[model samples]
Target: MSPEEAPARRRGRPTGSRAGAPETREAILAAARSEFAARGYAKASIRGIARTAGVDPALVHHHFGTKEKLFGAALEFTFAPALVVPEILEGGPEGVGERLARRFLSTWEVPEVRERLIAVMRSALTEDAAAAMLREFVSRELLLRIAAQLDVPEPHLRAELAASHMVGMAVLRYVLQVEPLASADPEELVGLVAPALQRYLTER
Candidate 1:
């Protein structure tokens, strides 16, 4: 076929281009963050993210392997609420505790994310780079966003309490794999845990 008649080459993923070119990868990651922030993990689409990045969807797929992997990458970089809780605060203050608890627990169950979370937690405890990342995210993205959503007076304090409680549950259930806690039905755990979080966030 003539050059004019040949198929148009995709941008970012050039013909014979190497995988993970710095500019392309950074572009994709930035677009991924924007997409995740706007749509949350479950609703964010690879096609949409690729478009946002000015790349092909196949490039994104080849780069990350799966949505779970991409989400994990996003979290490892910044630990934003979009990937962490998806849209936990979207439904408003009603049942937010259940939303937060359910989302947090379920997100930790994803294998790709679980691995990164382990790394993050360990590094955080040891005061590494991940520690700074987590601290910034929790203080800015997680806590303040959550605090802003609630009707409570000490919203920041309430948000902090809820985050601590949730993280403690994760340590026992996921990191340590404590029996009963680890083995318990998720709904049952959510039932047990959501009320306290709700009280922390909403109770005046």
Candidate 2:
């Protein structure tokens, strides 16, 4: 083949070594995060993420399997809220409030969590599907687990209210960037907030 044809052929494939699967996967995830944040799960298209990532759409399919799975991974990477909550609840009912507050504050302090929270909040507000997805995750994974552990009469309602409190605080502090509240120290915020959370979890 001529030199010109050879260069064009080489450029057709990804540059660098063929062992760039990991890098490609990371790129797709980064792009997926942005796309999902902007368009949300309902409107976000895999083709768009692939275009943003500078990879073939097939590669995205190969890596993530489907848009829903990709969205789940992106959400997991962003928030990780579901990870620590169970452990906090397991610690004992008495300290549940303080533990919940501490975990919430600490998680929000991370930039990615803040971004993810904002994205989810925006999607929840604007898209019916996104809102449903958020509600399902909160109810099925987060609240139900805590409700089963607690002795509250209306555990579902209490768990929901607790979620609202946490989500509201997140909206105010991270998304709205409200003064004093956003800048407040984690320990101080926990001290102020834990009692409310505890009451929600433990009160009859």
Candidate 3:
């Protein structure tokens, strides 16, 4: 090899030297969440997220492939509720209402879950992509799980009704913080709300 020939420039892009792929991916996700929050999913761009993350646009594409998938990853927190929902539904159908209410309210009362949900809800209000992702996840995962367990006419409708009431209660208790509803004991709230949820799940 002649000295002027030069050692071939190593191919492709240089690897990130400090963080491994997983850490860089996480950084991208964190930046994506912030970008989506600030700009909403429709306006949030791969280049913008990459800029916020201090990584190249190609890295974002390399990790997530597209804006849609990046938005989905940004909203990954929404999936955690699915994990707890089945546990809440696990008992005999008899007092499922009370169990569901107790568990649902209890779970969201945690600071982390409450804050995360508030952020998702805020994003969902303004972003069609955010709304679609959340709506699809809940309908398919949470509501349908309960509906499938019921042996009732129009079980899907029944499950939806039950979910609606719980959702309203959650909004009031956690989001709106409405008066006594927000401060009411979980047991007391269960007493007031569970019977209606029970009727929805079992009746007709």
Best by TM-score: 2
Q: What is the lDDT of candidate 3?
A: 0.76
Question: What is the TM-score ranking, best to worst?
Answer: 2, 3, 1
What's the TM-score of each model vs. the native?
Answer: 0.62, 0.82, 0.76
TM-score (C-alpha) between model 3 and the true structure: 0.76
Candidate 3, residues 1-204: lDDT per residue as tens digits? 566333322322333442356889988987887777667767879999988888778888888899988777766654576456567666767888888788778878788667656667777888787889888877887777877778789988888888788878878888899988889988898898899988887776
Per-residue C-alpha lDDT of model 1 across residues 95-129, encoded as one tens digit per residue: 98898888887877787566556655765575444
**On residues 1-204, what C-alpha lDDT tens digit does candidate 2 reach at each position?**
678557645766453232256888889988988887888777889999988988878778888898877876676666566667777888888979998888888887888767777777787788776677667777777777778888888988987888789888888888887998988888998999899999998878
Residues forming the 10-long window of minimal summed lDDT in candidate 3: 4-13
Off by over 4 Å in 1: 1-16, 19-78, 81-86
The pairs that clash in candidate 1 are: none
TM-score of 2: 0.82
